[model samples]
Target: MGKKETIRKKSPPPTNQPVKDVYPTPPPLPVKAPNNGRKNGSTTTGNNCASTTTKDLWDDLFDGGYRADVTIKTDNGDIIYAHANVLGMASPVLRGMLKRAKGCGEKKPISIHGVHQDAVRVFIRFLYSSCYENEEMKEFVVPLLVLSHAYNVPRLKRVVEVELEHGLLNTENVVDIFQLSLLCNAPRLTLISHRMILKNFKAVVATKGWSSMRNSHPGLEKELLESVIEEENNQKEKIRKSKEQKIYLELFEAMEALVHICRDGCRTIGPHDKDFTQNQAPCKYRACKGLELLVRHFAGCKLRVPGGCIHCKRMWRLLELHSRLCADSKVCRVPLCRNFKEKIRKQSKKDEIKWKLLVKKILRTKRIRGSVSFLVSSNSISS
Candidate 1:
């Protein structure tokens, strides 16, 4: 009747309990990376005193600071100022001026004479900056150079000379530059000018500067002509030596090839073929340079032919060339030529006579050597 119709009072529908709500976690915000271009060693602040350890400190320190100690008065009445330590470091003359001047405590301004105000300013700036302004300032280089020599500034003088030599070097101005170089005692520049004048001697002589120098500088023109003559002689000597060397190399190659053919011979070109006695076969190896002409001349060369074959003549010439090229003849490979050398030394024979004697001796030696080889072969065959 209710199987316990007492539905237990239905348990109040199990007291409807509230369920907790769930939410998804938001994706982590994308993390930003720092820029790579930030200088790692650099640190800075708005206040100048807070910065430290910069990459090139002297530039910023010498640029425009609150620590300048003295003023410079130039010949043109322009005034500039700089620190005493910088001036002292730049020139011994400046150091001495500071040391000797009295009645002042680092406030005295030094007066510079014989130099343009613009040049003096550039000089002082170079002392601090190690280099001056733009190309517009090139006009001041000569005046700066003069100032550098007067003040014993070697580094600045060298820089000025390089600028003049490279940047200002032209036919129109080279003579002036050369004169300035000579006056400044610049040896490298003087030598360079001398060579330049020699190279364009005609054009240089036609210039107004050369006309002025001719009236003033005497030994220089003579020196230039002598240098030109010496150069011509040197070139002639070089050409002669080069020709001699080329002929010598050709002779050596020909001798080596001839010896090879005389001995065992080659597969392509050997003495067994009658081609050795023919003079008209163009070579396939060394272009059309008469390389095959000597083979016919060497096959049956005779020592008693009253003169000699082309091969014997070349061999004789080779010996003579060896005597000339060799620095020391005491230990020469051409022992017979060494005796020939002694004979010539003793009797002082003419070159033509000595050459004929050399040819004869070479032919005689070939005959003797051939006979000895033939006799040896015959004896061996009989045994």
Candidate 2:
């Protein structure tokens, strides 16, 4: 009944007072269930955070296994990377060339060490993609040739040669393709291209000249000459059978007459005369006189005069006199002699009228005889 007994009684009465069971109040009826019916922090449900952690670990392991150093620098200033084995097989120079050739920017560089940039790029694309079916390739053939030679890629070189051959076959590109083929030392390409070039032999040979061709491609010069001869023969055959046979025949006769006058004028003038020889500068008095004599002879043919007629003979003699007199006089040399020039001019005018009449007669004759059997025969021989 002292202080201890009072304290004990107070504590005991506190425990027995209603004895309310203190069970957890059912977790406050969960404000909202976790999404997808997953219980928070419950092992029965899948552990998304743990799964994410496991994935991260696997990723680290996979990354570690696959990592490699594959970067390389190229001679032309290109930086690239490949697998170790690929690098081993590739030549150091080639690797550099490829990188520089491909370049490393959004805008590609123009040319590599003197080669056109687009050409090198095309080559790189072929190396990597194994295809070169672009139109740009046509203009970039020389650069491709350079690349092939440098890389020692025989297959690629062969492909370029094929493309060059095809290009040469196109009449429009024949000259340029032929030139490139010769420069690149492409024998087969040159041979194939030569055939196409022969089609325009007269125009090409005349403009480019045999001397220039000989100097540039001495090896092919003889061959080209032969081809030109063949083409000329074929052209002659065609002319023989053409509807314009009369026109062609007259032209040939005119040319022959012109040649005879030139030769006769030169012989009459004498080689010692500055105007008459190769020693004289071109376009001089002798040259003009020679050309004038040829023109006069051609005109005389249209006038229906015999080759040895007095008028033709007189015209030839006058042309020779004109050359001898006009050798040093610039004015008369350019315009020819005033009196002789007037006579030749009048004759030329009359000859032109006669030629026109003859052309009309030929056309009239062709219309009346509608059979083109001659043309067929000519075409067969020419073709």
Top model number, lDDT? 1
lDDT of 2: 0.49
* Candidate 2 local Cα displacement, residue 115, angstroms: 1.3
Report how far off residue 226 is in candidate 1 (Å). 2.5
List the lowest-lDDT window of 10 residues for candidate 1: 374-383
- lDDT (Cα atoms) of all candidates against the true structure: 0.59, 0.49
Please provide, for model 2 over 1-383, each residue's C-alpha lDDT reduced to its tens digit, 9 standing for 90 to 100: 56664344333445555645444445556343223321121223453454434434433432342332343334566533333333223335455544554434432222236565456555554443234544656677667777776666655677777666655246555565576667667778877878766766656655544456678778777777787888889989887667565654433333333333433344344222335555643432333454555555546465534355656654555443333223232333322345543453456667646544543444344445553212112221110
For model 2 the TM-score comes to 0.32
Per-prediction CA RMSD (Å): 15.7, 29.1
Model 2: CA > 4 A from native? 1-112, 165-173, 179-185, 203-223, 230-383
For model 2 the local lDDT of residue 379 reads 22
Question: How far in Å is the alpha carbon of 10 misplaced in model 2?
Answer: 84
The digit string of per-residue lDDT tens for model 1 on 130-199 reads 5555452467766776777878888777777777667665566567667877788888877787778767
